[model samples]
Structures are given as structure tokens and as C-alpha cells.
Target: MTEILLIIPPFCYGDLSEAGPVYPSMGIVCVAATLEHAGYKVKIIDMFAEGYEESKLKSCLEDPELKIVGVSSVSATFKISLNILKYAKEKRPDTTTIIGGPHITILPDETMKETYIDYGVLGEGDNTAVELADLIIKNKGSPENIKGLCFRKDRTLIKTEKRQFIENLDELPFPAYHLLPMDKYRSYGVYDSGRKTTSMITSRGCPFKCIYCCSSELFGGRWRPMSAEKTIEFIKKLYDEYGIRHIYFQDDEFTVSHERAMKICDWIIDKKIGLTWECLTRVSHVDNELLSKMAKAGCKSILYGIETGYEEGLKQIKKGITLEQAKNAVRLTKKNGMIAKVSFILGFPWESKEEINKTIDFAIKLDADYSFFTILCPFPTTEVYEQIAKEGLFVPEFNMEMYSAMPAADSLIRTKYLTSEEIVQMMGHAYKRLYFRPKYLLKRMLSLRHFSELKRNFKAGLSVLRFTVKSMGKKAKLAKTT
Candidate 1:
């Protein structure tokens, strides 16, 4: 008989920047399902989709029966979450407010220090959230005993032991899509591939130990995937119910298991579900045969993190990929008639100017249908973060909010080898070099097979241009002040 509300805070980006359209937050959906299954009446307010202002958020929080309010956050949206929590307190001072997600998982103690948040649930929240809700309803549970949670006791922060990683991802129920406000979300494929889009995750966690990545710290070192049958069932339901033709597999690495991935693809083909999808993959996991099979099964595109062009720089970042593998992946994707998108990072601590140019050259050589470049960010809880901290290289004032808005260029934790300005310059150079080539422009123009593809590409290019100009202006203004 208890009522609960799950809120996803609004994200920034006044204008759609170079980054593509925003996807719905799946984490909240998962938590909502878990709570509902436990017999709690749950309502989800997705601010990103609904475009709610402070007044609207306050109205939702004003309910006297709202026993618990669960909010989700990431490093990019940490401040927004904090603001929502503060507003919740203003409306109902006694409400039990809980904060969970990536940011909280990494800095549980620091998050618990904020008086607005009653508890922080670290790691996967499906199980922990249900348990917390039950405890609040029964009035017999102590927050201190909850694993993967942090709370304050007698004005001191208390973090319980970390929760063990979920072993069988299949056990978690399908995300409560029915509970979400589906119409509020806009759907479009990444490259305008004529498919209305949705996002899915067949797996949790990544086994790779990339220094610049925080997935391992948050999801643990092991990879866990849902069974192929369960994965296909979700896809079938998505197609039949939502009329969703496009799916973005938001997995950290979708191709980690060869047999499992092939089996999933086989199921899709066998069922003739006709769903077009995209996913992030490692170069080493893919080859011509697998890519061909996936393309035949309705894979429109594949994104690979070819972090660097130079082998040494790749090694420096612990990307676990070779230049040959990256090149072959691109070639294979193209050969299989699928759009290949390669993502690159500029300004590793050990990278030199020559290495930066090599990365640019490599991206140009691959000539993937789409390419993305970002500056190296040493987010907290990663090996890169620890290394920068040990060497006194991290910007002391850097917090979650600043970390998110820090231009992909200026975001780099300043290294002993590369100045922040140098990194910013490299990011600009990488984009300009990869995108402005005459041959590349011609190829893109010729490859436009439909009006939607042309329009999406043009808009995406303009967004990148706007972002670059804005980033440059900010840099120039900062320099003048200094």
C-alpha cells in the first residue's frame, strides 16, 4: 500500500551538441521494475523526457503519501540530481530521499555528506532499492546494514561493504518499460538509418581494464550477459509493442562473447523479427564473418573504440587493441555493408604531438561512416585518476559538475607531459583533420542513399561545428582573463 516515486533529473545541453540524440535512462526503469515486483506502488517521473521545471518537480515531491523518492545520477548529471534532492527537501523535509547511480557508486561517502540525500545506493540498484523500500515501509530496517549503501550515522559518514556483483543477469526482470512515459521520448537511429530507435542492454559490466574507463570499478571486473533467449524475447516485445525498429545496445562491449553474440544474432534472423540495431564493440571481438552475420540480422552500424592510432598510445591507455585490429575492424564492417563508427580519444598522458597526428591520420585512413573524438578524462575511481592523483596532476578544484562540462578537450586531468591547453588543441585538430578531408567529404556525399541519411549527417556535422566554435570561444575568453 506504500507509494514511491522514481525521478530522473534533467540533463544539460541547451542545444543538441555534436553528441547524438539523448537516450532514455534504462537504470531507473530497472529499479522501478524491482520495486513494483516487491508490491510497492511506483511512479516514474523522467524529467529528461517530460522537460519538467523546478515547480513541476516540487509538485511531485509535495505528496504527503510519497514515502520514498528515488533519484538517479551520473557524473554528468550529478549537480542536477543534487538540485532535485534539495528541492525535494524544501517541499517535504521528512521524506526519505535516496540517490543512486555511477556518481554515487564512485563517491559514496562524499555523496552521503550532503544532508539532502538520506542514503546512496552504490552499484546495481535493482535488489538494494527493493530492500530499502521494504525497510522504510516496515520501519524496522537500518540503512547501515544495507550492502552497497552509504548513509550518515551521528553526523559521520558510514559506507557499508560493497555488494557482490550479480552473477546471472537473466534473473533481473525486463526493465519496466510499461511504467515509463513512452510517448515523451523521441526515437531516431544514430545515422538516420530509417528505423525508429530504442536502447537495450543484454549485458552488464566489462572485463577490459582500460585505464581511462570506470566501468570495471562500478560494475566489477567480470562481464555478465542475459541469456540469448531472454535477450531476443525483449527485442521481440520491443518491436511488437513499441513498434521500435532500431535498437542501440548500450552495453560497454557487446561482442565480448563470440558464441553468445552469434547465438543472439541467429535468434534474431531465425525469428525474422526485422529489428535494426547498433552496438559498441571491441575491434578484437569482430571479423568479417561475424559482422556479415550481424548485418544480415539487421545491424545497421557498429561503434568501436579505437582509442588511439599509435600502438604505444593505445597501450598507454590500456585499450587492449592493436592498430592492425582497428584497421581490420573498419575494413570488415565496410565489407559487410554496415556503417562503422570509430571513436578516438586524444591526449593521453604519454602521447606526443606526433602520436596525435598519427591518430588523426589513422581515423582518416579508416574512413568509417562516422567518427567521434573526445579528450582524455581521468574520472575518479579509474586507474588514470589514481595515477594523476598520485603525481599531483589532477586539477584540485575538479568536481563532478566541472568534470562533466569540461570540454572534451579541457577535461583531461592535466598530466606532467601534456598541458591542458595542448590537449584542447589536439581535440580540435583531430576533428578538423578527420572530417575536412576532400576525399572523406566526397565519399560521404556519394554514400548518401536516402534523404533521412543526408539530413541527419548534415545536422550532426553542424552540431559539431557549433560545439567547436563554442569551445574555442570559451578557451579564448579564459586565456584573456588569465
Candidate 2:
């Protein structure tokens, strides 16, 4: 059997990572599950989980049995991911190197420019990874034959025919959680209690044409999900085998099909699978019945992307929801005893200061249990990124590091009406305004049910303060410069 190594490079997740919410990479873990099931010896190195020890990575690279080295990365971590593979090649020239994830999937040819990477897997890697590994390990077939793959051959980059999205998601193996450092995962302040918490994706893709999202491109703009039975089984496996007490569903819209979601909730209720969970979904996809069932079946939190406050900004972003719908969704979520966490993005290229302020005002007025205000990050492969690129909207200081959407981080692009610095300052102001309110603080304090909740709140609040102050300093500097 061929020994395969899959790596997730150390990437800063900004405030999220700073506030202690490290998670396993679902992409690589899924790939590992498929590869492991296919009889390959697979090892997963989560650099972030293990604290990025160069000596450990060096040791892994030295392993003679490691026939293939694979890495997964997003736009923010592409540079580090590339450097890792480059170093792997330098250390072990015999090992075949591959890279994949949103960044490489969007720009295959550009990623292949680094000769260190022998192949790039586009979109979902579960099936593609297995086929590629078999071909490489057995020297069985040409790289050109593999769909959803790109490679440099004879100094020419070749991307094969587009791979179809996996239709029956249930056929795919559950993510190989055993390969991950599961104990290292945490979800403090975001999920209840934080202990034994991990993230799962029950579905893939988004049907809505949200301009800032790349899910439609990556997952074929369809909502494909595992059967409710399979989903329950996976959840049970996590609870029983891994002792996972809390789960954060990383779905773009977990409640896309209310029927399926209701069935899932029913199973959790019937089986008494008592693990509390949280998920992200569109405002319109959820309603009173679903919220009621979700709360009963251990859904402690629900996060919604209310991208902007006003109607025009929402339309511009193709968010496909009205302010009234968002308000109703939040109201229902909280009414059903689940925490409603809403996120707003400021700094659209066409947005005026008043519009951005309106978004902040809306967030405060909506009064969800948690509110996150982020500056717009124009990720590649999204409609917003294309628009920004076409219009030369990116700021001079914009870089991949700012792609994490850290409120304090420099905005990547500027609107006609606002500079990047102004956008970031507004993000700071949004946080300070919403979080520092005596009403919000009193509500949070009253809602605390445990010491863990209090500790998590304190830590999270401290993180927000630090970021807010950092953002305010940038504003002061900008004022001086002007």
C-alpha cells in the first residue's frame, strides 16, 4: 500500500483563531477517509492543530514510504501551503506533491506555476483524490484522464474536463475524524460549553447567487446533501466513537430543504442523540417550525448572513432576502430558544457611509445573541472578486493575509465612496457600538448558564476589545496622514 500524507498548513483565521476556535479541515479529512477506505496508508498533519513544528514536518518529509504528499489551502493560506509543498519537494524529491482547495481550484494554472506542485485537485477531493492517488501510486494512467485535475505537462498546463459534483453525498465516507487531532478542537463563545466540539458539513453548495460567495462555482450551484439517515449515522458516530458533544455544521445552508432538516431533527430527538449543534443557513430557508424542532433537538445556535442592513445593499449582493425576512428569522430563532448570530459585511464598492452605518444600526436593532461585522473581502472565484478585479477596486495594501475577514485586518478592496481604512474603521465602530451597549452586556450576562459560558464570553469580549482598539489606531493613523 502507498503511504499518503495530507497536510493543512498553518493559516491565521484572524479573530476566530485568536479567540480559540481551531477546527479540522473537512476537505482533507474527507479525502483521507476516501483514501483510507481504498486501502492506502494515510496520515493527516494539521499544522495548526499541532502548532506548526518544522522539525515534525521535516521528519514526515524524510519518511521513505511516503509516496504522495497532499495539501489543502484557501486563498489566505495559499502562500504557506505552496511553501510547504516546495519544502517537501526539496526534502524528498521522490514524493509526488499535490495541492487543492478553493484557491487552487479557482486558479489552477496559476497554482501550477509553482513546479513543486505536481497536480491540483479542483472542487471536491473525495473521489478525485482517490483516483489521482491510484493512478500516481500504480503508475496506471495519464494525469490528463483525471477530471477535476490540472497539471503541467511539457511546460503546458492542462486542466481536464470539469468534474461533476458528487450527486449522492451519502455514498461518500464520513470524514476520517480519527486522522485529526480531535481533542485539540474548540468552539468557545461560538458554541455552548466548547468542550468536545467539532464541525461537520451535512450538505454542500448554495443555490442562491450570492455575489461574494464561491460555493456556487465550487459545488455547481446545487444543494446536494447526504440522506437524513446517513447524516444521523455520522452524527451518532461522532457522539459515540469520538465522544463529540457539540457540532458546528459548516453547511452553506443546512436548512435548504426544511423536510430533510426536520427529518434530521426528528432522528436526533427519537434517538436521544443529545449533542448540541449550531449551523449557518439563509434567513429565508428557516422558519418557526424548523426553529422549534432544531431547538428541541439540541440546536443551540444558528448563524445567518444578513450581508447588509438596507434593501439596496442586499439586492446589490444578490443575497435574495429582505430586511423583514432577516428580522423575522432572527426573531423566530431566538423565540425558539436558540441563539441567533447574525453577520454583516460592510464596504461594498458602491456603498455610501450612510449605507454602512445603516448596516450597523440594523445589526443592533436586530439584537441577535451575537453579531459579527466584517469588512468585505473579495475572494477570488466569487462574483465580487471578478467585479473588483474588473474595476480595479483592490486597495494598494490589499493582500491574501487580509482574506480572513478579520474586522481589524486591512480591507482588501475599496468602494467608490470609502477607502479601505475607512471601511476597517467602520467595522471597528460596528463592533464597539453593538458589543459595548449596556443592554447587550446585561443581556449576555443574564444569559450565562455556566462558568464556561462566562469564561468564554470574557475571553471573546477581550478579543473583540483588542481588535477594536487595533482598528481604532488605524483610524487615528489615517486621520494623521490626511
Please report the candidate that would top TM-score against the real structure.
2
Clashing pairs in 1: none
Over 125-244, each residue of candidate 2 has an lDDT whose tens digit, in order, gives 888998998898878787888899998889999999889988998898889899888888777554556459888988888888889888877889988888888998899999999999
Local error of candidate 2 at 142, Å? 0.8
- Residue 94, candidate 1: Cα error in Å is 2.5
Please give the CA lDDT of all the candidate structures: 0.78, 0.84
Regions of model 2 farther than 4 Å from truth: 397-408, 475-482
In candidate 1 the C-alpha lDDT for residue 173 amounts to: 80
* Among all candidates shown, the one with the greatest lDDT: 2
Report the C-alpha displacement of residue 443, candidate 1, in angstroms.
2.7
Point out the worst 10-residue segment of candidate 2 by lDDT: 473-482
